[model samples]
Target: MARESFAIGTVRIRPGSARALELPITRLVTGADVTLPVRVVHGRDDGPTVWLDAAIHGDEVVGVDVIRQVMGSLDPKAFRGTLVAVPIVNVLGFMTGDRYLPDRRDLNRSFPGSARGSLAGRIAHLFMTEVVAKCEVGIDLHTGSDKRSNLPQVRADLDDPRTRELAEAFGAPVMLHAGIRDGSLRHAARERGAIVLVYEAGEPLRFDSYAVEAGVIGVRRVLATLGMTDEVSEPPARPSRECRSSGWVRARRTGILHLDARLGQEVADGERLGTLFDSFGKTLNAVYANRDGIVVGRTEAPLVNSGDAVVHIAS
Candidate 1:
């Protein structure tokens, strides 16, 4: 069967074969014409449409690498459904090496955005309308923000059977049953009856090869699960323990923080995960996990204030 042709603004592209296209946006102050870059691979046969988006937080580059590698390696002739890949969603923030847009708005928190709103909002709206609305399933890739690092994991509302199936199919090392945050893409997509998996890994502004490879493998696994591609050899055994709940372990006293644990490390109840020390090298307080769980995320910067989250544990 012949593939359908579509246009995002003035950019016209066909989808049966691998194609890279750009949807132009309004000109920015830097005089550079902003655009959303998308790569589409549509198979000749009809099947489920899946959209894989990365770099929603501009500083998260691991997903960008994964998208690149996945796109470069995929064969459209072998695919059954449409695979839309958006490598960088927040262009301004990506250019600045920051998580938020130049206007200080987080693109991830601006979903279901308005046609008439801030730059971030407009971009979010464009994505929701142009990319997301077209897909039956989505994989929104992300990484830890600021100075924090996250182990490769899938965060989703596993309460839903469909969502759980997708999360399991993702094959990440860990799966966290996280609540849907307001204005998040997953939340917005759920409202539209679409199941989207959020894959978190590495840290902002840094690329981890293992994390990238894992992401690529996970995405392909999802495609296979959706019948978009033939099942290849099974992926590596998933160290993936499912977490029923997760939360941040915050500091009780202000001081220099010293972390004794790493992402993906297991901690016991009341375990000393880190220590806070004064400028004079005197111990101020010891940080402990209140419950036994795996350290899914941790702050990399040593400085901390009272009430600051130092670790994120999932049980």
Candidate 2:
């Protein structure tokens, strides 16, 4: 028998078909309805159901474009399984170019949300129910926040054999072992027996072509790896470095920052990575790497206060 239609929020999408939907969240102060936009592509063949979510933070928009490109390349008639995409999860914050919702809550930290809860909590709950609970695996796309740019990397609990395989197949430059944080979507999904990969790249509010391309290809490769699609790209020329641990190097002084290291640069312990400059051009303090590792992230803001995180190294 042919597969049954994929159902979400009372909408039934038949096999080899696709649909775009908006599930009502709430009404704005102006009385306009706020809703979550969802895209579903149901395949002709039976396969695992996977989801791709992005913009949980609103300003992290590279994933929005990534989803668009990836979906455009897929043919529901030839595809397998179902793909549920929530490209814009924080419409409220996204409209204002803010990271947090108007309620000042981080949407991502409000997972497994409630029916009778705060705005962020409600959205989280709806997503957990309507999207996550129905999928076997997913990719949570993100970008560096607060003016920092990241090298395209995958962060997950690499200890799991299957999870590790998926991360490796994604082929990001660095695969970091990161534990699930409380209230995070990853944590909630894991609790319910679903596996998720967090893909971090670029900086918020800007589209770096490389990061976008990397994410698009990575998603396609993962779909292929999961046996959900036949469109696959070759592995990245450089194998992804497996990072068991990573840390941030903070600024030692408040001043105009000048970073000497680039993303993915391998540096030794105590290497001078940058310098803090005073108005008169005098060096306020020279920043150095705290350990031997590859630079995966750094601040893009010109000024940072003392003890602010300046660079992230994965080793």
Give lDDT per model, in order. 0.87, 0.94
Checking candidate 1 for backbone clashes, the offending pairs are none
TM accuracy, model 2: 0.99
CA error at residue 97 for candidate 1, angstroms: 0.4
Cα lDDT of model 2 by residue, 1-315, tens digit: 899999999799999999999999999789999999999999999999999999999899999999999989889999999999999999999888899999999998899889999999999999999999999999999999999999999999899999999999899999999988989999999999888999999999998888999999999999999999884757778889998899999998999999998999999999999999988889899999999999999999888999999999998
Candidate 1 residue lDDT tens string, 92-146: 7888898888889988888889999988789988998888888889999999887
Give each model a TM-score. Answer: 0.95, 0.99
Report, for all candidates in order, the number of backbone clashes.
0, 1
